[model samples]
Target chain A: MMQQERTKVILGVIGADCHAVGNKILEHVITAAGYEVVNLGVLVPQEDFVNAAIETDAKAILVASLYGHGEIDCRGLRGRCEEAGIGDILLYVGGNLVVGKTDFHEVKEKFLEMGYNRVYEPGVLLERVIEDLQQDLQERGLSRD
Target chain B: MELKNKKWTHDQFYAIRGEVLNQWPTGAAVDFAEAVKYHENIPAKKHFAKQLVKAKKNGRTLTQPRAGVALINEHINLLNFLRTEGEADLLPTTIDSYTRQNQYAEAENGIEESKRAGRSLLNGFPAVNHGVAGVRKVIESVNGPLQVRHGTPDARLLGEITLAGGYTAYEGGGISYNIPYAKSVSLEKTIYDWQYCDRLVGIYAEHGIEINREPFGPLTGTLVPPSVSHAVAIIEGILAAEQGVKNITLGYGQCGNLFQDIAAIKALEQLAEEYLNNHGYPDCVLTTVFHQWMGGFPQDEAKAFGVISWGAAAAALAKATKVIVKTPHEALGIPTKEANAQGLKTTRQLINMLADQPFPLSIEVQSEIDIIKAETRCILDKVYELGNGDFAQGTVAAFAAGVLDVPFAPSRYTLNKILPARDNHGAVRLFDIGNLPFTQDIIDFHQAKMNERAKAEGRNASFQMVIDDIYAISKGRLVGRPH
Candidate 1:
């Protein structure tokens, strides 16, 4: 019997944000759920995420922004991913995603319009994220064999 | 440059001071001789070290808040408001992020931008950009003693400007500021830079001026275990003492468990004194600071008050010299002055209520203290052995070998192998101990506590629990249980 290789996923806190707690948590939760987490750590650029996804053939890129500047930092990230030729790669973002208290529905709709596959409000459980990843991966036929 | 835990000679210090003071145009204003004279004229009541000594003698827990703004007059007014309306016992001049990064040019622009906008644009006071005279203006305007609260990895020029400007206390150590605050700064570099800062304080002490030096005790502040933080605090204390610093205040973040929080403070004070004395620095006056929960707070203002009050109760009961207050607007970005004062008043009320109430030294707290001591001793011993009795070398090696890992630290120097989670009662336990130099018995103790939580939650002891615990407090719970 041969062991199977884990499915690949990219994770990081996008832009000049240095919040590492949630990014580390995401890595742990995703890796424990049987995925090869390419943790980009904190203060990552938009290009790094797309480049990593393309290099590793990761099924998804989980971008986190906790410094409340995600609106500006994350702008046009999807178009950059498309230019890098991994536009279809799943993009999941969460955490204090806006400058102040905005309706979650509005925030979520805005991110979706920006081409993110999913947008999470602050305090969403990691379990829910992992489940979403599994379902999304399966629907895209990118699930582990 | 070979880094060692030895004190720099006056010649060596002056040589570096020449360059350090030339970092920006503001640095040119730092005249050590004149500054010492100015410091001599500061009233004893407005002296940071003097006030802390008085607080310790009276068995009082002082309250301080984290605050600053871009402009000078606004910053002065803010500190005064916190002193009067908030009833903060101590005041802080928190430095802006650009200054923390040594980006004085950007800080200058921030000051200009703030002036044109008719409102402060920066998160904190740009002390370095303000220069000695500017800092002196704010220092002279504020009623109480002020401390420079910042996360600068290289605080050499900032230290010169602020100290010369009349701030009596400085916060952050090489290790404390670097590992948690920077992404790629080396331990050797930060530790070396911080030695210069400490030496300046020592020079002040030599001139009969005692300046308080605090090692930021809350590394990463997210689920950090007691032993890890304790080990870092003791190391930093010894490092400061080596540089001739005589007055040191070590700090610790609230871990949320009452017994554990109190035990941590007791263990930190005792361990710091022992290490400093054993290292041949017995004259150092040590104080302890309890930082109100450094993690996420509930978005609701009422719930935020509960968190702040709990932290105050812990600090008061622990009899720490002072408590760093947190605002109810914590969950929402930078707090308004009113919210900041409300947090301080809330903490003051709790401290006033709990001042006379004695927290019992129960068996649970004793056990926690004992465990923390043993675990901390193990790490310190390894650090010593790794350095061949040199703390500077030992610290760099400890992080490299994963012997002194801080959980969730962003430094490339640290191995970052440790993972912390809460147990059944919300006490932090290691899910993965990483390469921490803990004895088998200590490892077993943490594992058992983790196992108990797993059983209670009807879940396996895995990373899921760690995730849940991270957001538990913000969701208004201690232990994150399955719903």
Candidate 2:
């Protein structure tokens, strides 16, 4: 059997949010699920995510905001990624994105509007994020395994 | 920039007000005089200050839940549900993040998008985006007092819009909102911004409108020692009072130790009154709000209810003027409205059951109270000394010198030098005092407390203990001991 190349992805909690537990858990889960994760720790800025994406040639940038300020930090990230010439890069964000009790569908729609390819709700199963990533990458013809 | 205890002059306030009102379109709609008129017409029952005063006099602990969504109608419906279903005594319109960051444009887009989708796109009520008219619609729909609960360091616009919209209470202070919530907000800047908020309240208070002001208590909501949070609340309360705020509700986050929780509340109310009186604000009405456990919750709903009920019992026993309830779905992301209601129901049941019970005054409880008071005095005296008797100035310098510290806080402005761990009895004690100015005896007290826990666990008092304690409650243990 031909050896398959590992799918690389960048993961982090973004922008002044130091929620390490979830980031650690996500990295472990994704790693165990057979993906190479470039864990950027916490408090990651937008440029750092983009730079890491280009540096690692990662297929996706998974952003987590556990402190309810995701919309501000994740806003215009897609545009910024495009400016960095990574427009087609898969963008995912979730976790208490806004401060108040917003509907998940509305949160999802807002992220989609902001150019995120997928937005996970807080407490969303890790397997779902992985399954969706696999399907999305396969659809984009980026899968090696 | 000198952090003195001086109220802003009308001209100075107007100069800042001009720029503030221009921050967003809603700013222009906030006619202070018109807002005053609207407030005057609002019934006494809907006034937060009046309700709080009544609760304090009656010795009843009011319950308030955190709930907000994007659309105005939905947010109103949610608050109404909390009022009827959750049995909340006070309601909160938690501001959305975009508005908290002053990103009114994005918040505006969120509101419109929410309307188009027939669902709330924003996480909060987007009070600024809603402006006065929209917020007034919410105020009109709600049956009781509504507060604007948000963690905005620069809440000048929010304060203006919400107060104008008939919100009777506003939660947050410069340090409380800044140190825990933001990463890079300077102490100097947040104090100044919060002065604007207090001054806005002052402006209303001057017009014979009593608005309740609360400082974000439970700083970082980790294993914060009582004295640490107490010192901050007293400072923020004095700051609010200096700005002419007559009604102050200082808050403390539940530390998961019952005796310590009761002691902290009693100490907070006593110290606030003492400090305000010494500062010549004899008229300042002091109240206490006990926030339910603000740290990690168990993933299980039943376990989460245990945490909520524990907090409720503590709040009731402490005779706190109000309790900020948490939902059973806390470990999860923002709770559904139903979950929020469930949390309030749990809290209501616990408080009501314990309502007839008086807080027991035991020898141990008395000692904890005395120790907490002494430690708080040490911290506050150092802060006052640092500011040369100016609380605001001292606060800035205190954080700069690490004389005051909050552990696990994200703000670079906070010293983050203090490390806290539960004692043998699960009371939060300082594991690392850092630059906190404490007497040698107080320092020894904390050390001895930790030593007792360490000896029991057969381990040295170390950072590992702090880490364990952080997750202990989630694991159904208070003291995180190694196997």
Candidate 1, residue B38: Cα displacement in angstroms equals 1.8
> Model 1: DockQ against the native?
0.26
Candidate No. with top TM-score = 1
Residue-wise lDDT of candidate 2 within B67-168, one digit each (tens)? 888888899899999999999999999887667777788778878877886766566788987889999999999998999998887999888888988899
Which residue runs does candidate 2 get wrong by more than 4 Å?
A: A1-12, A15-45, A52-62, A67-145
TM-score of chain A, model 2?
0.95
Write down the worst ten-residue block by lDDT for model 1 chain B.
B461-470
RMSD of 2: 5.2
lDDT for each residue of candidate 1 in B185-234, tens digit (9 for 90 to 100) = 89999999999999999999999988999999998999899999999999
Per-model TM-score on C-alpha atoms: 0.89, 0.87
Each model's DockQ?
0.26, 0.17
DockQ for model 2 equals 0.17
> Highest DockQ among the candidates is held by which one?
1
